[model samples]
Target: MRRNILPGLLIVLVAVIGNRLSPNFLDFAYLRDSATLVAELGLIAVGMNFIITSGNIDLSVGSNMVLTACITAKFMVGGMPAPLALLLGVGIGTLLGWLNGVLITYFRAPSFLITVATMAMYRGAAKALLGPQSVKAPSGIVGIDTQTFAGLTIPLLILLVTASIGAFVMQKTIFGSWVVAVGSNSRTALYSGVPVARVVRTSYTLTGFICGIAAMLMLSRLGLARHDLAMGSELDIITIVVVGGTAIQGGAANVIGSLLAFILIALLRSVMGVANFTAEYQMTIIGILLIGMVLANRLPLKLILQKLRPKSQRAP
Candidate 1:
């Protein structure tokens, strides 16, 4: 309950501010439309939760997503079926994610450095494939943006579905437990017969697959694929996970928390945009938010509890 309070407060605060700025902000149609903008980033945030919870990070997520989208668009323009091209794109994402896992687990390199290098490499490769221009997607995919199911847009539906799956896996699966245990202590887990390497690989691979899904959604909404579809978005995704109470070191995460954080962020951005704030300034504000979260979390909870304790029950 406490974990959810911050995001809830943030949402209310943003809503209040937005109402003051624009009467149209609270309308159901406008809010639903805004969901489309956050869907792609939200998906990546959800995916990153798994990797972060399992004691790792992937800075290449933005590049991985763009690369997959670029590949998918290239195929679609080559007269391939949209569905088939999309599948291939997802497959590429999965493969890239698996590669990240393999390199990290087998080579024993730090995830931060490895992913950093791959981030540049993947983005460059994507640019090489798509050049400096936007590649338009086929009609089938371009039409996905306007798609709705039972009054919910396709991206929102997909976001909800992905979040549900993540929640289920984390709550009721052996794989989820392994990830937590590995992050808690790899040496102990390995000694206790847990397959640490496999767990790490699986976690990253899953993040990759989800990135693919997110890419397709982004492409559908934009109707064009670029070499920079999600450029530098890895920072926002990481911030979303960190702000959701996931530890950068390892262990502890909640999909719902991350989802709510994403919503708060999107709402804040919308309000800022309405106020005519520059995008560059918004990035700085978000960075400050991340730092504040980290600092507050680092505060001494025990000391606070001690201060709140009755004098009669005080310890030496």
Candidate 2:
């Protein structure tokens, strides 16, 4: 609890300091927009947390979002009902996720290679469907333009719902226990009667499902969809998950931490935008932060702390 609480407190502190530095950051509109952005990336990060906690990675989330957006765009362009179109988009995303799972589990392929291939395939399919064109949303989707609830954007609402569900799953379910166990040791989990393969496969499926949800929110927010949507979001998503304190090697994970991390990254981007920094510089800073966190994870900070403890207080 202390570990998780500390990161969130740090995020709040940074946000407060950032807002103080730039009064615009405290503007209701700016904060709302930041929440929306965090929600989008955070949704996928939550699923990634589950996957990482289950001892695997799903690199196909970006492509999955693209595919979902493309499918929704195609349906909307063809004059389909909005609800039906959205449903189709989600279904397509889930199917793609299942495909990833099947290949990785049944065929015994490495998850990294399988997801990488699927990522290309999914993105290629989106491009082929849309072909360098973009499509706008049809009429009647809520909050596409000129609306707000309690000063919060609709996208932020979506993000909040998604993150809440994710937190619930991680902290209050048998599936969560299985996820941790699988990450710790698949062999031991399997021997203990846990369905290791099934758990992993399900994680990818959930990843796709959440990406689909993000796709809908993004489409609604932008009022348009393009094959190129979320072109480089995979890196951002992974960075948020890592920064949230999920182990890359897969054992422990922090869903709430991932949420806070997403907010932190979004705030940083917003600050950078306000500061008029070039996009390249912002990316460089993010890259540096990612490297620093990775290095921190690898270091024996725990052992060092133990060694530094007072002799009287040290464990026997």
Candidate 3:
């Protein structure tokens, strides 16, 4: 609960500042529309929360998203049915994620290194497949963002449903418990009969599944897929996870916190755009914020306070 306060406050602060910058900032319809834009990122962040909570990371998520999007778009443009293309994309994403898990568990190497290598490989594969070109998603599959049910966009609804399910899985189920245990201490968990390898692999695979969904949404909204799509998005995704108060090291899962953090991120970007901040400036600010949150999470509160105190008042 304490971890949620900063993001909640930041959301309010951004909204107030946004209202000052643009009349539409506080407009419900405008904000609702803006929510659609970040829905893809939100989806990925939810899965990322699972990955981090399981004590693993997937730097290849952005690449996975792009690769899935590209493949789906290519097939759709090549006259395949939209439904088939979407399923194919999800399957490919799942396979890619499973591959990452296999390599990590089999080689017993750090997930960070494994994912970093796969990240490059996946991106390269996408680039090779779609060299210097973009493919238009089929009209049948496009416009999902514009579709509404009960006055909410499909993307937003999807995010809400996914987050809700994720929250339940993380907090209530046996699988959730296993993930937490594995992340907290793999050796201990294994000794206690927990399937550590399977837990970690499942987490990564789940993240890939979510990434696939994100790719579909992105393709639907943008109507185009390129190798470079979602480039550098992993940064924002990780930032959302970290800011949501999920432990970066492992053993924690905060799905609701992640959902709220994503909203804060979306609002911050909206406010910055309304204020006419350049993309470069927006990224720089977000990067700094990510770093700050990481430090705040890693440092001990007493140590932080001690440093803030004057030398004359320092503890002996």
Candidate 4:
């Protein structure tokens, strides 16, 4: 409960600020549409929470989304059925994640290094495939994001459902326990019969799986697929995870907090947009937020405050 306060407060603050900036900002339709805009990032961030909780990271997710979307776009342009293309993209995404897992487990390498390399490889592959041109998204897949059910856009609905399921899995299941145990202390978990390698691998693969889904929605939303899609989005996703109060060094996961953080992020962006901030400014803000959260996690605030106090005022 305490962990969620910051993000929740930020949401309210952003909402208030946005309403002041743009009188229509609090409109239901506008908020709903804005939620759709963030669905892709939210999906990837949900998976990222799991990976971070398992004491691992994947810098390749943004690239994975682009590459998967590019592949699907290629198939669609080649006259393949939209459903088939979408399914293939998701399968490839899962396979890409599994590959990351295998390489990490086999080499006993840090995921950060492996994923950085894979991130470049994935982005390079997308660039090679498309080469400064975007493939046209197929008819069926193109408007999926615009479609509404129960007064909510399909993308937002997908996000809500996915987040709910992710929350349940992380909070209720034995697999969740395994992930937490491995993250908190791998050696101890291994001694206790936990499959540490499998947990790490699964977490990466799950991120890739979610990336695949995000890719499809992205393609639908943008009406095209290109190598440069979602460039540097990993920063925002990581910010959302970290701001949600997930420990950077692992051992904790906060699904609900992340959800609120996503809303806060969306609202902040909307506020910035209302105030006419450029994309560069938005990126700068996200960068600052990411750095601040990381430092906050590492810094001992209470101890620092204790040292700052005068000797006479300090506790014994």
| Cand. 4 Cα-lDDT | 0.88
Return the top candidate by TM-score: 1
Candidate 1 residues lying further than 4 Å off, grouped into runs, are: 309-316
Query: Candidate 2 at residue 121, lDDT?
Result: 88
lDDT over C-alpha atoms for residue 166 of model 1:
89
CA lDDT, candidate 4, residue 285: 90
Total clashing residue pairs per candidate?
0, 0, 0, 0
Indicate whether candidate 3 or candidate 4 has the larger lDDT: 3
Candidate 2 all-Cα RMSD: 2.2
How many clashes does the backbone of model 1 have?
0
Which residue pairs in candidate 1 have backbone atoms (N, alpha carbon, C) closer than 3 angstroms, thus clashing? none
Summarize candidate 1's per-residue lDDT along 1-316 as a digit string, tens digits: 5777777787899999999999889987677777678778888888898898888899999999999888888889999998788889889999989999999999999998999999999999998987889999887778575778888788988888888888788868988788888888889989999999999999899999998888888888898889967766887888888777777777777788888888888788788888999977878878888888778778887799899999899899
Q: Pairing residues by index, what is the TM-score of model 2? A: 0.91
lDDT of 4 by residue, 103-123 (tens): 998899999999999999999
Candidate 2 accuracy as lDDT: 0.80
What candidate 2 gets wrong by more than 4 Å, as runs, is 9-21, 142-147
lDDT against the true structure, per candidate, is 0.85, 0.80, 0.90, 0.88
Please identify which of the two predictions, 1 or 4, would achieve the higher TM-score against the true structure. Answer: 1
Model 2 clash pairs are none
lDDT of 2 by residue, 1-316 (tens): 6446545765787678777778667776776676676567778898899888887888889999888887887788788999998888888777878778878889877788988898898999888887888887876653442456776676666666777888788778988889999999989999999998898889888888888878877777777878877766777788888888888888788887787788778877777777788967877877877787778778887788889999898877
